[model samples]
Target: MHSTIFSLLVLKVSSGSAMKLRSRFQPEAVGSYRRLLCSLAASTHSVEESSMKSTITKKSIKSEILRSKSPTRSPIAVLQDWIKSGHKVTISELRFISLQLQKSKRYHHALEIMKWMEAQKGFQISSADHATRIELILKVQGLTEAEEYFSQIRGTANQKAASLPLLHGYVKERAVEKAESLMMKLNELGLLVSPHPFNEMMKLYMATSQYDKVPAVIMQMKQNRIPTNILSFNLWMNACGEVSGVAAVEAIYREIMNNGNVEVGWSTLCTLANVYVKAGLVEKAVLVLKNAEKKLNTSKHLGYFFLITMYVSINNKEGVIRVWEACKSVSGRMTCGNYMCMLSCLVKLGDLVEAEKVFVEWESNCKNYDVRVSNVLLAAYVRNGLMEKAEAFHVYVLEKGGCPNYKTWEILMEGWVRSQDMEKAIDAMKKSFAMMKGCHWRPSEAILMSIVEYYEKHGNFQHANHLIRMIHHFGLASLPLYKVLLRMHINAQRPAFNILKMMVKDKIEMNGETSACFSSLCKRESARE
Candidate 1:
């Protein structure tokens, strides 16, 4: 027992030696070392438990998103369910879901997510949040409601967040007058306005070929003491390169390059190259592109693609291939967008085999599969007159659990029609109408024409009527579609008076197609007489 006690004392002395630094406060220490260890273990367990709970929350949120049938309604319902269940949804979580919705082009449902956040208890949304909501409204609603929303909420937010989004919307709609007036109104309010809005307006003018006004916009920026960003300067340089020559371009470039406050951007260099190209200075353009190439970030697929695009503009196929090879050498996380860009380039180059390989690589890896990517290949096949191949590939895609959208079926219909297979085209149309749920999913003119011709030849007025009724039911309007139905009825010697009445009730205007169909009806009646 003496020996055991001596050994225990030795161990205690060793441990005590390790604790010498804390010895000064030992009298004030609240717990023994064992108790302190227990507290630390408990703390670690609590952290692990919180981590597990967070994982579960994320899973529940995802599952909720997957549970709802409608994209437009799903997010809203899930958010409401969370609130009702006393689950705390973080802003980051909300933004993540909103980002997914935005990427999927589901603006209405994204808006619903924002709406839920706004309605949350004791939540004060930033101007940025309100601006995001405005952007969503612009997309799902329209310019009018977006403007109304901006005007109604201006008193509560900063000018940048409130007005800039609307200005962007106007730029999209090409509403020059409205954008200018809004800018003027913002100026009158004496708010802190940035050069970015003016830059956007200037680009709009440049796109519309109003080169003279670009300088005025730049002058306004200078007058306002707004720090002109590289992008705006690039736009100005592009416009001024023709009128101001290489000297002016070089002077400003040097100024921007020397300014310690200003950082030179790749896009700025690209714009400089574009200006050189416009001024008949191919060598100068090549030099600018070389400088851009030197600054090219290999990890960014878009940068390489942009370079490839510019090379294509210069008609430099070899340069494009070299840049593409460089892009392939980069080690990084390749996104869906990168795959899409590669596919697009390959398709443009008629490298179908390469495209398919690139496509398969993405197809195996991508979780959120978009049918549009598949359609690009489908259209490629159809354009090459490989209808059978297109159909077979489409079937393969569907069997592989691909989400076949309306455009997918539309491409199928178009391929059949292009091959003059009216029977198959009509069948495709029937399938399209059966599944048509929204305005964006309407069949093309070529698809509709194939159906109408098939109906006219088959004299199946019943089927034609059904097809027309379905098209209008989905809110897809086309004068040609209506005219074809009328013509088919007239040719079938069936009473299309009811069809005409339906058109009148639906307020279908009589265009050239409708008028020609009516003229055909008159000729048929006279012949019968």
Candidate 2:
């Protein structure tokens, strides 16, 4: 069926302009194709692949793990492998694969997939599909780069597709003004940008702690005649809860229930339960949680997941296991999001043993070896000050040909720095920078400060100066950096006048305090020299 649902597109040049026609595939054909992909994915993986751990030979274990783990394979690498092999690849297959990578948060590979698709023949992109590609750009290149990309939309892309997702990106970053501007554009274009973006705007307000502004967004939605869903109420309740406390949240819940304009979903019930718990109404909270669980629609995998996390919030282990096992029985295979929620719940409860078990199960079943899952456990270990465990897992990941992302390295270094293990902290810091080579990863301010502080605390001014020099070489200048370098020259009793000249060359203005300090320090250094 996958082989049968080929999307055929014919590109035409009219008036020396390229025109795109949407590829058509029947609903039944798409359903069949999805089924085929599922079956193929299931068949390619064996249930007992890693189960025979101790009994397997070293060579066999390496072979099996390399084939199954694939933790380091980029999306482009997958395509390149196919292309180099001269394997026939369909546009639909590439599209599906790109979507999978995107969902997995492998944006680098996903973008490469889209670029590859763009260059291929008969790869038609509709406005709808193009919307997703724009989101891919936002994820891969970040907000500033994505803005540049949106500014330069060409070809058959319905520009609105790019703009709408950019609005969502702005909301994600809590850029209220940008979100408002983009929303206005959507309204002007009459593009029918769905309620999801509005909901996101409310979320942004909540994140920024602008609780008072939330109601204004809701009022705007109503004035525009956009229907508000239960989630809108849930976020609205969160805002009300934050500002006016439990009493306000309770009153709002009652008002919403009595008004009857919106359907009271299970999430609404959970919100009430949360507020009840906050109010110390344990019996009422329990009753509402029971009602929420009772309202679970078994067909939807998300409801069960929500219930599990809710139970976790209440620290009800029995309820968590109950919902988890039941969901697994029905959903067949657990998604990474589900596992992320479950693992995070366990971590929040401080049940490291249970978290480790879930992580093992996740690793055994996970495709692409998503490092995020490992990072979750790493975060827990680092949070608990269990640096040994974190280092063990970090080494294990590297040995398996997997690279830890920037956050992973930061966590490890932060832990080492906390323990005042400067050697290990520097090692971790170097590894983080090493991993960033030819990648978009940037050194975070916190990590940079930790290294700088450690070096300064130990009177290693020369090393700190070298670090600042590297930062300047990267075209990044911080205000306090010049002061540190100046101090370093004085400490080393070196040619302080040369550093003063370098500062002048870099156009760092000398305030009175800086000038006096530099003049005094340079005289002392010259005397010592």
Q: How much is the lDDT of residue 368 in candidate 2? A: 70
Instruction: Give the clash count for model 2.
Output: 0
Per-candidate alpha-carbon RMSD to the true structure = 20.0, 13.9
For model 2, the stretches where C-alpha displacement exceeds 4 angstroms are: 1-263, 277-283, 308-319, 437-450, 453-462, 474-484, 497-516, 524-529
Pairs that clash in candidate 1: none
Scored by lDDT, the top model is 1
For residues 223-330, write the lDDT of model 1, one tens digit per residue.
667777665677666656645566767777887888787777666677677767666788877778878877777666666777777766676656676777788767
How far residue 455's Cα lies from its native spot in candidate 1, in Å, is: 3.9
- Best-fitting candidate, scored by TM-score: 1
| Candidate 1: residue 237 Cα off by (Å) | 2.2
Query: lDDT (CA) for every model shown?
Result: 0.68, 0.65
